[model samples]
Each structure stands twice: as C-alpha cells, then as structure tokens.
Target: MQDALIVLVHGAGIGAVFALIGMSFNVVFNSSGILNFAQGNMLVLGGLFAFLVLPSSPGIGPWFVFLPASALLMAALLAVQGYLTLLPLRSSVEQHSWLITTLAASVIIGAVLLIFQGTAQQTVRSPFPSFWFLGTRVPAPYALSLLLALVWFGLLRWFHTRALTGLAISAIAQDLDAARAAGIRVHRLQILAFAISGLIVGSAGFVAAPVIAIANDSGVSYVLHGFVAAVIGGLGSDLGALVGGLLVGMISMYAAYTYGGEFQDAVSLALLVAVLMGRPEGLFGRPAARRV
Candidate 1:
C-alpha cells in the first residue's frame, strides 16, 4: 500500500511536468499549425536559467523573482524563434519549412548549452526540504510541480473560455483563414501563442528542475516523452494533455518499480503504440471530418 502511494505521488509530480510540456506543444500547434520541436530545449533553457539565477539555498523571495524572469526570458527567446521559423514561409501549414527551422533552432540551442554547461548533468538543490509521505521520502519540487500544473490548467481554461485575447487565439486555432478574414491579426496571435507556449514550459522546467536533472542532452528525451503525452491525450486538448501526462508518469513509474529504470521509456513507447493502434486521434481528441 505504501509503495503504491509513493508511486502515485512521484508519478503525479513528474507527470504534471510532462503535461505542462505537452500543453506548450498544443499552444503553438493550435495557432500556427507548426510543432515547435525546440520546445524541449526551451524547457531545458528554463532550468538552466533558474540554475544560474538561484543560489544553492534560495529563499521564497528568490523564487518569486526567478519564476517570472525565467518565464519572460524564455517567452522572448521562443517568440523570436517562432518569428524566424515563420519568416521564410508564405503559409505555415502550406510551406512545411518549420520542420527544418524548428529542428535547427533546437540543435543550435542544445549546442550552446552543451558548450557552456559541459556534458555533465547539473542538479538544482531544492529550496524546500524533503518530507516523508507514508514510507516514502517525497521531494518538495514534486508537490510544487503538481500544484503548478493545476494552477496552469485553471488559468489556461479561464483564458481560453473567458478572456478576449484568448478567444482570438482560439479563433485562430479553429480556422486560420477565417480568423484572418475576421481581422483577428493572425500573425500577432501566432507569435503570442509561441510566447505563451514558452512561458508554460519555462515555468515547468524551473519547478521540475529539482526532480529532473538539468542537462543539454536531456532535451530529446523530454521532448519525446512530452510529445508522446500530448499525442496520447489528444493534441490541442489541455485537459487531455494533463490526463495523458499523469497516465504516462504513473505507468513509467510502475515500470521502473517493477522492472528497472531503463524499462520506463520502453513502457511509455509501448503504451503510445498501443494507443495509436487503437485510437489514432488520441483518447480525448476529436476526429476531423474529411470533405468528400
């Protein structure tokens, strides 16, 4: 029973982070119809920024400062990447240039991080102490990550349903041509989506840094897992991303606990394959109607 509880807590924590990354993917995908492959690197960059800014034993005040600062910086950087990725093309969906541009941006970011941080994995010391949950020692960041996920989801939900700008963003996602035809400023909204996506992942990276090691090479793994989560939950569905992330996190934890750490990724991939085979649109995704 204790083992089960421990697994649940740990899974939820890491899963929350994955869900955030997935939602970030959905944000940009919705507005621009382009998947920013550099999202994972942006997440790592967020953690790197947090590592540089925060001290070994940071206080609450520092967190308040670091979170917004890291998020804003990432937002700006990703916005620029979005601009460059979209600049050479006439239409985002029509050109398919983003595939190369986004990947190149990711590689460039990884190279820069590698050059500066070296190949070693960097750990961020948690400001809060570990607490015992049942028989398991739970880290503070884990709980924090879960809380952040909840807050983020709520805010996003409200933004999409209530806010005027968010409604515009949603309109763009629904139909780019229609949104533009309605004078919604499609280009500006697309850039905003990129910025918002960066903010989501940046904050996630900062919060999850203590749990996941910060390393330049880890971006691929993060992106892969997050992408899986997004797909499993159904792309463009924020709630689905959360559900998918939690499911992935729990299953991976179970695999690790039962077999070994190495089997976690294998289990996740197998789950993805199973889901795709059964439902290509994802568990929560709606199927698009094709015109005959």
Candidate 2:
C-alpha cells in the first residue's frame, strides 16, 4: 500500500512536469500552427537561469528574491527568441522555417548554457520541506510541482474560456483567415503564444529543478517526452495533454519500479506505439469532419 501510494505521488509529480511542457507546446502550436521544437529547452533555460540566480541550496530567502527575477529574465529572452523565429517567415510561403528556426534557437540557447554551466550535473534543494501524509512520505518538491501544474491548468483553462485575447488566439488556431478577417492581430497573438510558452515552461523548470538534475543536454530528452505527451493527448487540447502526461509519467514510473530504470524508455515507447495504433487522434481528441 505504501509502495502504491509512493508510486502515485511520484507519477503525479513527473506527470505534472510533462503536462507543463506539453501545454507550452500546445500554446504555440495552437496559435501559430507551428511546432516549436525548442519548447523543451525553455524549461532547461529556466533551470539554468534559476541555478545562476537562485542559491545553489534551497532557502526561502534566495527563492523569494531570485525566483521571480530569473523567471522574468527567462521569459523576456525567450520572447525575443519567439520574435526571431517568426521574423523570416512572416511574409514567406515557407511555413516550415519555424522548424529550423526554433531548433536553431534551442541549439544556441543550449550552447550558451553549456558555456556557462559546463557539462556537470546541477541539483538544487527544494524550497519546501517534506511532510508526512496519511502514513506516506511526500517530497516537498513533488508536491510543489503538482500544485504548480494544477494551478497552471486551472489558470490556462480560465484564460482560454474567458479572456478575449485567449478567445482570439483560439479563433486564429481554428481558422487563420477568419480570425484575420475579423481583425484579429494574428501576428501579435503568435508572439503572445511564444511569450506564454516561455512563461509556463520557465516556471515549471523553476519548480522542477529540485527534483530533476539540470544538465546542458537535458533539453532534447524533455522535448521528446513532452512531444509524446502532447501527441498522445492530441495536438491542441490542454486537457488531453494533461491526461497524456499523467499516463506517460505513470507508465514510466511503473516500468522503472517493476523492471528497472533501464526499461522505462522502452515502456514509454511501447505505450506510445500502442496508443498511436489504437487512437490516432488521441484518447480524448475529436475527429475531423469534412464537408464536400
């Protein structure tokens, strides 16, 4: 029973991280109709920023002072990156340039971090302390991570449903021509998507740094797993991304717990294959309708 509970907590924590990444992916994809492969690196960059700004060891003083500062800096930098990505393709028919641009941006960011942080693994202590709950131990970082995920989810849901800007972005995602005809600033919204992506992933990294060691090469792994979660949840569905992330996290955790850490990737791949084969649109994804 204790083991089961532990698994559940750990899975939830990891799932939240993936869900955060997945949602960031969806935000940009929905708004711009482009997949930013650099989404994952935003998380890495956030961690790196936090590492340099925040204290190497966790404490309330350092966290309170540096967390927001680091996050803002990361967001601004990534927003600039967002602009660079769309600059070249704004008037061109080559819509796929985002693939190269975002990837290149990610490489550049990684290289920059590598130059400063080196190849060493970096770890930080959780800002919050662990506590016991119902006879099981809960790590503070995991709890904080899960809380952040839930909060981000609720806030995003509200934003998309209630905010005018959010609705405009959604409209653009549904039909760029219609949104433009309605006088929606499609270009501005795309930039907003990039900024929001940075915000979400950057905050997530700030919280998740304690749990996962940050390294220069961690971005690609995050991209792969987060992409799988987003794909599994359906491309543009936030709730789908959440569910997919939870499933991926649980599967990976279970495999590690049962077989060994070495088999976690294998299990995740197998599950992705099974899901793709069974439901191409994802578990909660809606099917497209065509009108002749």
Candidate 3:
C-alpha cells in the first residue's frame, strides 16, 4: 500500500512537470509556426545560471531566490534568441527550415554545456538551490516547481490577454497575411513568440530538474513531449495545449509506472497516433485543407 501510494504521488508530480514543458513548447509553435528544438539549451542555461547566481549577493532565502532568478534569466535568454535567430528569418523563406536550424542550435548548446561545466551528463549541479517552503515534509524542490509553474503560467496568461504584443501574436497565428495587412507586425510578433516559447520551456527545464533530475539525453524527451503536446491539443491554441498536456501527462505517469519509464515514450507516441486517427485535426486543432 505504501509503495503504491508513493508511486501515485510521484506520477502526479511528474505529470505536472511534463505538462509545463508541453505548454512551453506550444506557446512558440502556435504563434510562429516554427518548431524550436533549442529549447532544451534554455534548460541547460537555467541550470548553469541557477547554479551560479542563486547563491550570490544578499543571499535571499532558497525559496525567494532560485525560481525568480532562473525565470528572469531564461526569459532574457529566450528574448535574445528570438531577436537574433527568428527575427532575421521572419522575413525570409519557408518557416519549415527553422526546424533544422533550431535542431542544430540545440546540438551546439548541449555541446557547450558539456565543455564548460565538464558535465558529460544533463544534470542540475546546483548545490542548494531549494529549501523548505512551509515546513512540509515534501522536498522543497518539488514545491518550488509547482509554485514556479503556477506563477509563470499566470504571468503568461496576462501577457497574452492584456498586452498589445500578445494580441498581435494571436493575429499572426490566425492568419499571417491578414495580420500583415492590418499592420500587426507579423515578423516581429513571430520573433516575440519564439522568445516566449523558449523562455517557458527553458525555465521549465531548470525547475523540473530539482524536482526530478534528468539525464543529459533527457532533453530529447523534453523536445519530443513538447511536440506531441502541441499536436494533441491542436496548433495555435494555448488551452488545447494545456488540456492535451494534462491528458498526456496522466498517460505517461501510469505507463511509466506500469511498464517502466523506457516504454513510457512509446506509450506517448501511441497516444499521439490514436489521437490522429480518431481526430485528425487534433483534439481542438482545425484540419488542414486538401487542395487540388
């Protein structure tokens, strides 16, 4: 009974973590139609920053420092990435080429992390990045992750709802040509979306580690889940991503527990296949037209 209960708890926690990762991926894809594989590097960046900055200066208590600091840095890096990488390409050829570019970038960043940190594996090296938040028996790292996700999600919601840039982003997603006609700044908005997407996934990697440490190659799963979640929920719909992420999260949790984590990846792919066959448009995504 005890072991089963533990498994259940762990599964739920892991599910939440995965959901966050999925949401991050969806944000960028929905707005720009670009699939970013370099997102995991953001995770690596967060880890390095958290490992270094969180412990410096006035020394804010563990709970007060790591989350915000990591998020801020992640957001900044993502912003830079979007400005430099996507901004130039926004006016260029087919967006599909971005997939290849980002994949290559991810490879480069991963290599840099290994070289600088001398870590051949993808592990969070922060010595004491978290601490007891409310005296709860649960590890501080887990609690921190939950809090960070909620806070970041809320902030993202506000940006998407109340900000001019956010609205413009939506316009681009609905129809880029129309958006351009309306003076929506399509290219710039896409770049912004790219940054936002990277920020979400990148910070997620950082917080996710303390709660559930990952291997170096674990980034592959992160990227893959983000892709799957985007499909399951439907392209360009944040709500859809959230719903799809949660659904997939539950499935992954149970599958990992029942069939071992190794098969969990296969199960997720299976879910994707089933979803495609049952609803080709995704749970909420619209179907693409077939032109003669």
Tens-place lDDT digits, model 1, residues 1-292: 7888889889988888888888999889888889888888888888888889889888878988889888899999989988888888777867798999989998998899889999888878778888988788889988888888888888889988999999998998888888888999888888989999989998988988888868878888888888999999999989888899888998999899989999999999999999989999899988877558
Q: Candidate 2 residues 184-228, lDDT tens each?
A: 988888888888887788888887887765887888888878888
Candidate 1: deviation at residue 230, Å?
Answer: 0.4
Q: Model 2 off-target regions past 4 Å?
A: 90-94, 133-136, 289-292
lDDT of 3 by residue, 1-292 (tens): 5545545455445555555666676677667666667765666566556555544332336635566667666777666666666645744325566766778777877776666766554334333344432332345445555555566667767887898887777667667677788988766666667667656665666666555434345566666776687678776555566667656766776788788989787898999999989997789787767448
Best-first order by lDDT: 1, 2, 3
Prediction RMSDs, each to the true structure: 1.2, 2.1, 4.0
TM-scores, all models, native as reference: 0.97, 0.93, 0.81
* Segments of candidate 1 deviating more than 4 angstroms: none
Give Cα-based local distance difference scores for all models: 0.88, 0.80, 0.64
Which 10 residues in a row give candidate 3 its minimum summed lDDT? 128-137
What clash count goes with each model? Answer: 0, 0, 1
Candidate 3 positional error at 232, Å: 1.8
Cand. 1 TM to true fold: 0.97
Residue 257, candidate 3: alpha-carbon lDDT: 77
Clashing pairs in 1: none
